[model samples]
Target: MPKKLPEVILYTDGACRGNPGPGGWGALLIWNGKEKEIAGGNPQTTNNRMEMKAIIEGLKTLKRPCHVKIHSDSALIVNTFTKGWIDNWIKRGWKKSDKKPVENRDLWEEMLRAAQPHKLSWFKVKGHSDDELNNRVDALAVAESKKF
Candidate 1:
């Protein structure tokens, strides 16, 4: 029989002081009843970039291929993969319907690479609600943004 892959649950969030200002990303990884948290920030960036950064960083932390379910408050992040925005973007050579270059293509490409090794599913969690882990990562992101 084939071995079952391990399972991981990841929660992520991002925060920015302004549309294009200091920004931060946070992630929490849970596996085998343990947890790992990571966060970082950029002096100047957009909230979308930070949101992508959180997922990218979290996925990069896994040691090998696994089943990973990612939870995020940002609809952009969740829907990009879940609703097939990424597939169309790739089909269109990273251009939107209006032929504009996709914003944060660099991170999207990097995230694609980071995620290739795992089987992933995306979930959307309401931001700033009663979801404990989501709220925790949100706090982490907000704190990290305050540093810059």
Candidate 2:
């Protein structure tokens, strides 16, 4: 019988004072009863970019392919993957249904590459909610944004 792989749970958040201003991202990764926290910021960027960056950085932490469950409050990120927008985007040469180029193709491509090694499930959580992990990452992201 094949060995069972352990599941990794991740919670991520992002914040920006303005749509195109100082932005930050935070992520919490849990695996095998252990937890890791990661965060960073960009001097000038968008909230959506920060959100995707959090997921990208979180996935980069794994040493090997594993079952990953990613939880985020951003509907953009969740829906893009969960609603099959990503697959169609690739098929349509990175253009949206409106025949416009995807706004964050670079980040999306990076995310796809980072995610390729694992079996992933995306979950959308309510932002500013009572979920402890979600709140923690949100706070972390907000704090990071304040640094610059």
Candidate 3:
């Protein structure tokens, strides 16, 4: 058998009934033509946490380092990487520009750690748009959140 490529594609979405109410996260990971779906919910959490959790869970599933491209509708998630906010936050001891502590610091730390083993690229997609994978994940997240 031919060796599989070390390239993975991930689509993630999060949904919450209220800003700090029940929430859920969904992720779809594709590698070498294989698909894996992962999801979870929190009884009391923010949308941002669910968003971060989606990507974190996806990355955590990788057994080995790979080149990963993550697609997310959350600007907070996309810009954090594409705009180099993660690096700055780390350099500033997890503080934003105004020296205030970053929100979701715990989740951010876990996400950073989960992503460290992989070479990652972040992409921003229009939420609830025509993207099939993105839409599917969004629906999944909504359904999961409703369970709580």
Candidate 4:
């Protein structure tokens, strides 16, 4: 019989004061009723990079392979992962359909690699809603961004 895997839930958010200015990432990781918060920032970065970083950090926290549910408010992040856009990029050698260079290919590729060891489901949640965890992550991201 297969070993029982831990059920993990993660809520992530990213923020940027300006489009290409101060940026931060936040995540809330929950397992077996316990929760852990993760956050970071960069002085010069984009919101999308922060979003990808949040997922990358959250996944890296896992000790071993397990089932993971990732929640995000960014449609670009959720759709790109769930709709297989990343795989398409990989197949096309990290180029988009238009054959243009993929922006943030580094972070996206790192996120993809970090995600490979687990069973992941990407879910989209409305931002600034009543979701407590999501709101918490938003706050964390904002706070981190302010530090820059």
Candidate 5:
């Protein structure tokens, strides 16, 4: 018989003062009603990189593979997996349909590696609106960015 996998929920967000300036990424991981928050920042990074970092960092924190449901305000991150863009990109040697190199291949590769051991579901949420957890993560990301 196989062991049951624990279910986990993750919420991630990122913030940057300038387009290519100081930035931070934050995430919240929940399991069995307990939640853990993690955040970090870079001296200089783009909003998209920070966004991907939040997800990658969150997944990396997991001790073992489990069923993970990831929620984020960034549509690009969510869509990259949900809409099968990652599959095509990997198939095309990390090139987009336009034959250009993928902008964040490094992080995208990390995202794939961090996620491969688990069952993943991606969800998009409205940012700075009514979602309480999303708002909390946004606050965390913004606060971390200010520290840099």
Candidate 6:
């Protein structure tokens, strides 16, 4: 019989005070029914970077391999993973079809590598919703941004 993998649930969100200003990333990790919050910020960054960082930080926190469900409000993050954008990026040597440089390629590559070890699924959640955990994460992210 194949071994059973533990289930891991992650909810992530990112906020940018300005497109290229202070930005924050938030994440919620749930394993074995216990929940943990992870969040951070950068003084000069974009929303996409924050979204990627949220996932990277959450994955880094895991102690062992597990099946992971990632929920994020950013369609860019969710769709990129789900629609094979990262694979295409790698195949093109990190350049887009139009031959433009991939924005945040470094973080996107890191996110892809971090996800490689797990059975992962990406889900989209509505931002600014009333979901308690999601709301908490957003608040935490915003608060963290103020420190930068």
Best by lDDT: 2
Model 6 clashing residue pairs (backbone):
none
lDDT of each: 0.94, 0.95, 0.93, 0.92, 0.94, 0.87
| Alpha carbon lDDT at 105, candidate 3 | 94
Ten-residue segment with the worst summed lDDT in candidate 4?
A: 2-11
Candidate 3: C-alpha RMSD after superposition: 2.6
Error of 6 at 30 (Å): 0.6
For model 5 the TM-score comes to 0.97
Instruction: Single out the weakest 10-residue window by summed lDDT for candidate 2.
Output: 2-11
- lDDT by residue (11-101, candidate 5, tens digit) is 9999999999999989999999999999999989999999999999999999998999999999998988889998998899999999899
Q: Across residues 86-119, which tens digit of lDDT does each residue of candidate 6 receive?
A: 7898899999889999999889878877877788
CA lDDT, candidate 6, residue 83: 95
Error of 3 at 54 (Å): 0.2
Q: Ten residues in a row with the worst lDDT in model 3? A: 2-11
Check candidate 2 and list the clashing pairs: none
Query: Model 1 over residues 28-119: C-alpha lDDT tens digits?
Result: 99999999999999999999999999999999999999999999999987888888999999999999889999999999999999999999
Q: Using lDDT as the measure, what is the rank order of every candidate, best first? A: 2, 1, 5, 3, 4, 6
* Deviation (Å) of 130 in candidate 1: 1.2
Error of 6 at 89 (Å): 1.3
lDDT of 3 by residue, 58-114 (tens): 999999989899999999989999899989999999999999999999999999899
Is candidate 3 or 4 superior in TM-score?
4
Off by over 4 Å in 1: none
Candidate 4 deviation (Cα RMSD): 1.0
lDDT-superior candidate, 5 or 6: 5
Q: For candidate 2, write residues 1-148 as lDDT tens digits.
A: 9666679999999999899999999999999899999999999999999999999999999999888999999999999998999999999999999999999899999999999889999999999979999999999899999998
With candidate 1 superimposed using the best TM-score fit, by how many Å does residue 16's alpha carbon deviate from the native? 0.4
Q: After superposition, how far is residue 131 of candidate 6 from its true place, in Å?
A: 3.0
Report the C-alpha displacement of residue 36, candidate 2, in angstroms.
Answer: 0.7
